[model samples]
Target: MSGPADDEGSPPPAGYVPAEGRGGFSTLNGPYFHRPGEGELAEQAFFARRRHANGLGLVHGGMLSAFMDGVLAGAVFRGTGKTGVTIHLSIDFLHMARVGEWVMGEARLTRATRDVAFAEGRAYVGGHDVVRCSGIFKLMSRER
Candidate 1:
């Protein structure tokens, strides 16, 4: 039942889906979900009080890494219409994100082979850059 404060007034950003019930990690770092659009995929998470923060009162780097993974992986899925697993992930922390802020992550598929796809993205707080990431994902066999 943990989520963004009820008092917050902004509606969910355009194209965002509720991340609830997606699974454990999503629930922990989330109520996070994606907004897939024409050129890229955007994933969003609202930073709750303690769950996403480190001792210094900034949003933890690990949290941003997870968010990047979700968004970049999602970009691969949406781009190829295939499910994928991360084979590799890299992130660069650029700025600090504060609690009670909405963090936005956007990613786009870079290239793909028959089995692997590559992608890169960034996470932002309002207009401030927070983290940038790239990932390689192995496309799973199509389920039938």
Candidate 2:
């Protein structure tokens, strides 16, 4: 997987960190993750190759879903300071994301309880909204 690249090639965005420990599934979609603002978690991805694209050359919907899942989960974890498991995810694909463009996912934890979290997020490419999603997660523990 590649990051959103500039003419000089891919570089991590400012304030972003390498999502090093997010696990193998996450590694496929992330090179960098950023907190664009308080309460918002974003992940940057480049549709660098056909592998990341659909037959029509747009980035795959499944890929966008996965991206949202990761960002939303991060938002929940950030809010609760604990791990959570996905209980449900609802996403709408609003636009097609093209190869070579940067797809940025931004999510917020709308509400969190002692054992659950609710979040909503969107994916954007060049200012176009590609996907909007909401999710529920079951907080795994209260410790921390």
Candidate 3:
């Protein structure tokens, strides 16, 4: 397991001021952002208001795709303690996740090279799968 490294190349994100968070958006941005020099595994939530339907009220394909991207990217963030950009992503829609339902996404480490990471991910509505995705994140590692 990768423990936190005190000698880790970069510094902690200076934006996470504890006091600012309780009041509003902190000077240090929230962990759920695409920030360089930060941890992986950022998550964003989607509520019912963000859903659309085929006259039957289901989440849109584009919305699901965006969620998957965020989830998989976050996984890549966790595996490598650095910032990365999504080079490509593919999604497989298994079933329609209805509106008012919540879908949770996760990224699994499939492979990793020095500059790239391959990850497979899925979105689950409760216990059933709603979407599946796989992709590569281009990692930018600063040489010491």
Using TM-score as the measure, which candidate wins? 1
TM-score of each: 0.83, 0.82, 0.63
Per-residue CA lDDT of model 3 for 1-144, tens digit only, reads 122211221232343211222113212122222223244443333332222334556777877776677667667767765555789999989988875554556676577898998888887776788888898888887421
Query: What shift in Å separates residue 95 of candidate 1 from its native position after superposition?
Result: 0.5
Worst 10 residues of 2 by lDDT: 1-10
- Residue ranges of candidate 2 with Cα displaced over 4 Å: 1-9, 36-48, 142-144
Q: In candidate 2, which residue pairs get closer than 3 Å at backbone N, Cα or C atoms, i.e. clash?
A: none
Off by over 4 Å in 3: 1-45, 50-55, 142-144
Rank the models by lDDT, top first. 1, 2, 3
Q: Write the per-residue lDDT of candidate 2 for residues 1-144, one digit (tens) a residue.
A: 444432323554566555668787767555545644554554544434456678787888888888888888878877788777999999999998877766777777899988899989988887789999999999997655
User: What are the lDDT figures for the candidates, one per model?
Assistant: 0.77, 0.74, 0.58
Clashing pairs in 3: 15-28, 40-77, 40-78
Which candidate do you rate higher for lDDT, 1 or 3? 1
Residue 52, model 1: Cα distance from true site in angstroms: 0.4
Winner by lDDT = 1
> Looking at model 1, which ten-residue stretch has the lowest summed lDDT?
1-10
How many steric overlaps are in each model, in order? Answer: 0, 0, 3
- The predictions' CA RMSDs to the true structure, in order, are 3.2, 3.6, 12.6
Better of 2 and 3 by lDDT: 2
Q: Distance (Å) between predicted and true CA of 117, model 3?
A: 0.9
